[model samples]
Target: MEEKSWSELLAEHSPELAQISRADGEFLDADSALPAWVKQLMAMQMDAVFNHPHGARWYGRRARELGASREQVVEAIKLLRIFGGRPAMATGAEGLREPSE
Candidate 1:
């Protein structure tokens, strides 16, 4: 079975809000001075710090796909620990775990 996307799930509950979210995502995803991987990594950090594990995992995967190194991801998590404390670091680490584990 096909899985529903985040936007698709959002759309089921609130179409207008989903549209706005999609537009916002498109705008944020536009090409900029920062590379795609950097943007995705930033998003991953924010999600992890904010306690959105699912979003953190999603963004972390995207960042890796875009060429972010494991070291880079670890450094980001360390930064989170410094700024966002241990809980954030723990959550972010969880997001980095392999699915099989």
Candidate 2:
């Protein structure tokens, strides 16, 4: 008889909550596997996050600081899958082709 957020629901339902690290440099999916849909959503979100003006700037800067390639930043974006807005998969897909700075 109580209201809960989507994150709470996910925490209750997803096994990843118990396994995935909440800290930096922690392995997210070491031995466990993610559901197909969750993986898809993460991919979409990551694309949306990386394609924004701020996102691109931050990513480029970080990549440069780390001596990594823009392509690596782009790939990391896809792998991380966190976006500002709930970007549609198609938009995220479009981001994949976007030229990096």
Best model per lDDT = 1
Clash pairs of candidate 1?
none
- Write down the lDDT that model 1 would get: 0.84
lDDT of 2 by residue, 3-78 (tens): 9865577568884863452331132222237533233334334445655565345435644454555565566565
Cα error, candidate 1, residue 91 (Å): 20
lDDT of 1 by residue, 1-101 (tens): 99998788999999999999988676546557887788888899899878899999988888788788999989888887787776666888998889999
Q: What local distance difference test score does each model get?
A: 0.84, 0.48
RMSD of each: 10.7, 12.9
True-vs-predicted CA distance for residue 86, candidate 1, Å: 9.5
Error of 1 at 87 (Å): 12
- Which consecutive 10 residues in model 2 have the weakest lDDT in total? 23-32
lDDT of 2 at 55: 38
Q: How close is candidate 2 to the true structure, as a TM-score?
A: 0.25
Which parts of model 2 have CA positions greater than 4 angstroms off? 1-52, 80-101
Clashes per candidate, residues 3 or more apart or on different chains: 0, 2
